[model samples]
Target chain A: MTTPTSRTRLSPQARRAQLLELGARLFATRSVEEISIDVLAEEAGVSRGLLYHYFGSKQDFRLAVIRHAVEHLVEQTAPPAEGEPLERLLTSLGVYVDYVLDNLTLYRSLVRAAAGGTDELRALHDEGRFALTDRIFREDAQGEILTDTPQARLVVRGWSAMAEEMVLTWADDPSVMTRDELLSVLALSLPALVDLT
Target chain B: MTTPTSRTRLSPQARRAQLLELGARLFATRSVEEISIDVLAEEAGVSRGLLYHYFGSKQDFRLAVIRHAVEHLVEQTAPPAEGEPLERLLTSLGVYVDYVLDNLTLYRSLVRAAAGGTDELRALHDEGRFALTDRIFREDAQGEILTDTPQARLVVRGWSAMAEEMVLTWADDPSVMTRDELLSVLALSLPALVDLT
Candidate 1:
């Protein structure tokens, strides 16, 4: 929804990405209550009307930021290939740790939004975690480590929750464990959480 | 720090509890930025200065509300005795689920505060979860079920994180699973994660 002005013309995709990046920075520093479309527009070098045209409202913009952040994490933690399922799982965990470290502020804001009970944010959070869980379960099934009684789904859900919280904790205290070591241990231990016997 | 007149009227503990209760309700309904000290004082039926006297600042008041909420949850989830470690663990999970269902808005606000990254709020969140994890580990050790290793700590940490996120997800989707059923399955599968052989 970019208005192709003679002075300032950019592709729609580029403009949207710009807005999301700026908005994510603002959200990281302040509460959602402190952010407004007017401020975002001013910061993004666009008109207030243009901001609305692009994002609809502040809530919509916040939702967009959450989506962008989640997508970024998902891309970083893409499933590994050509290894033991446990080794691949450890690689994914390493990706996750790196992602959190690189985007600490954005990740914290995303967690706040997810835990805040807004329907939009909740759906976005669930979608990202559920996709990861599905991947994990598929890998576990391939390894003959899953049961047929829906227990695998529960364990995956539990692992997703665990990873999310663990990353947050790691952000607070990076010295607790090195990223590689934590990921390796998690990789080694996950098989036990499944029916590896 | 109540004035002489206010001191004559109410006991210190009752007044503190009352303020925290009202603060929780106010924080749940409105954005934290929108709730001023004066507004909170008026809502809680106290003078602005008196509220400050009791809490020192808005941040302190928010921390008090968080601590109060956690303490209440702990009271609800008193550990079960005379049972196997897994059985007791399941009982604790059931208590946690029921508490969350009964106090959804409050729980959401607490989670939001935890994820907000304020130092005080983060400490409060960690203290509560760690207390529960320590108790669980103690019970498992006494029952000769838990391994003594850094791995045990990771399992405890992972379980703590999983429990927090699961409560958040279940709060959004009440029909996902019955509280008792989820806890029972968790109890059965938890050993795999903890090396509680």
Candidate 2:
């Protein structure tokens, strides 16, 4: 029933990756609710059946793309294993800001998905935040494994939200200050905010 | 031509306010996109024609509800006319927190509408944010009007977003801390974060 001209020449893994990349690109600027599987398949030059064959459903595909983006972020912003605490923190912050600046679409897409009011998206976002906060706390504590108390959890969660908003605001309008100035402000603010609780 | 049983027996202004109140209650938990005009009208026990007659359209009614909510917030949290700068700021923060706690539904509705991604909603949200930030800045300045630089605007906006997220998180799970503890953390954090820039 299928014409040879319409067939994708890539292998299954390559084709799946291709579709996911296309999904990330489109979802970077558009909401998941707005994009349909048919249109996504059409845009990717694949059949809807093929798209479904790789990912069981649209929700499954969205979750896959989210995981892909989160892994990319964690890899890109991974902190140094050994450095001065403050220096390591600053470097990590710089890496974060740089990544956002370099990949505005991907960063925005990730943030929007995190805040898009779904259990899966929210859980994925929290997973990323917990990893980042744990790193920061460990770095600040000089490798001591601190107790993850409710109070500590609350402080880190609050700090994470603040950091996210700061980055989002700076990304939306870098005219407020140079990237360094924005980074410095965030670095100064986070420790003080986290220490309050 | 009209059935007496289906008519609302209130003055036009009263009927309009009734419909708007209904809208606020519904929209607090539901997005405008999810709620239909006919559904809203039916919920208010009025004809769709009467609902349209008062507000012209669904979007118009939504805007009106947003304005009403913003005005209510402004009125509720309007800082005391006389107090020390920090004192006044804390008082305003307390009032704001109390209002949000007292009227979670209305607060959620306003925040959702502001973040609902339409141009109109974004603009309305900006309007409310500017008003709140301006008040905060003026109060912190202690009766002196400071220059509203882009950096200042960015900081206040970032702080506002942080406050919103913290309150939302706390509201969703008060087991983390008491309302007073959460408020104290926010009150302590905002100044430090805003002072960074």
Candidate 3:
């Protein structure tokens, strides 16, 4: 019997992971709404039934892709534990800037999603935000720059919003400022924001 | 003959303004989606026909109310022309914080609207944002705290986002920080954000 699409010899788990990676890759450049099951299955060389078997539904597939991207952003931008506090923050921020640039379209979608995405998508976005905060609190646990206080937490949360806006604006138009200039504004502004508080 | 709703002996323009004012007042406490024409007519003591006559459909009424709120916010937050640069920024921020506090529900609605409001409502929000930048640029025209460059415009734009997030967070939970404490954090942040760049 001739198969209509390529069927890899991977395990079910590996196949699922591979499909999600493909979904994420597609989602990065375009919007989730535009990603069709037929297209995804065609791109992944899988049957439509297999895509459904893995993801349950189209919405489920989109959420998984978004979740994957959020996890990647959190994992990629984490600061090394042993570095100087300032260096760690800036280093993570640099990775973050690069991450957003690589996922520029997703960033735009995220802004829209944060404003009006589904409750599921919004909850995912919230998890991503808290992941950043938790990452910072880990450094704060070392008693380096930030102290673990409610006020500090608020500042960090607000600063995340600030950084997101700055990065988004810069990414939308890099001609407005050099990447380094944007990075400096972000890295320094956190300390500057916390100073008054 | 007695009118079922309260109809004042006012001119057409005056009555229209009065209806819009009542709409704005109700919208502040609740949401646009929840504000029915029947309830509004009852609240303002105007006939349903008159409400429609003044503001067309329900959607038109909703947009007008949102636009009214945006205009009031922009008009109320503009800084005085003759003041120290830092003082002007702080005073405007102070008023802004109070404005958000007084209109907390609308502010919450605005955040949602910004994320997923109709194009018309989003454009109104954009107008309010630009109005702040224009207010600052008016001062920048005198060669004050900012030089009128594209970079400066971007900075101001991002700073407004930063300030909005900060205010929203604090307003959501005033127990996190006292009012003045929040104000200080906001006022110090812009200069600090600009210092590095």
Which has the better TM-score: candidate 2, or candidate 3? Answer: 2
Separate DockQ for every predicted complex: 0.30, 0.46, 0.58
Residue pairs of candidate 3 with colliding backbone atoms: A115-B115, B5-B45, B6-B45
* Pairs in steric clash, model 2: none
List the candidate 1 regions with Cα displacement exceeding 4 Å: A1-9, A25-53, A80-88, A137-151, A171-180, A185-197, B1-10, B18-60, B80-91, B137-151, B168-181, B188-191
lDDT of 1 at A129: 88
> Rank order by TM-score, top first?
2, 3, 1
User: What digit string (tens of lDDT, one per residue) describes model 3 on residues A12-85?
Assistant: 88777777778876766665567877779877777899899889998888888778878888999999887788
lDDT of each: 0.71, 0.72, 0.77
Candidate 2 lDDT, tens digit per residue, B12-101? 787777677777777766755666678776666667887788889877888888777887788778889887766666777789888888
Task: Please report how far candidate 1 places residue B21 from its true position, in Å.
Answer: 4.2
The total number of steric clashes, by the backbone 3 Å criterion, in model 2 comes to 0
> Model 1, range B141-177, lDDT digits (tens) per residue?
7645575555566667877777676666656765656
Q: Give model 2's docking category.
A: acceptable
Q: State the local distance difference test value for candidate 2.
A: 0.72
**Every candidate's chain B TM-score:** 0.86, 0.82, 0.88
CAPRI tier of model 3: medium
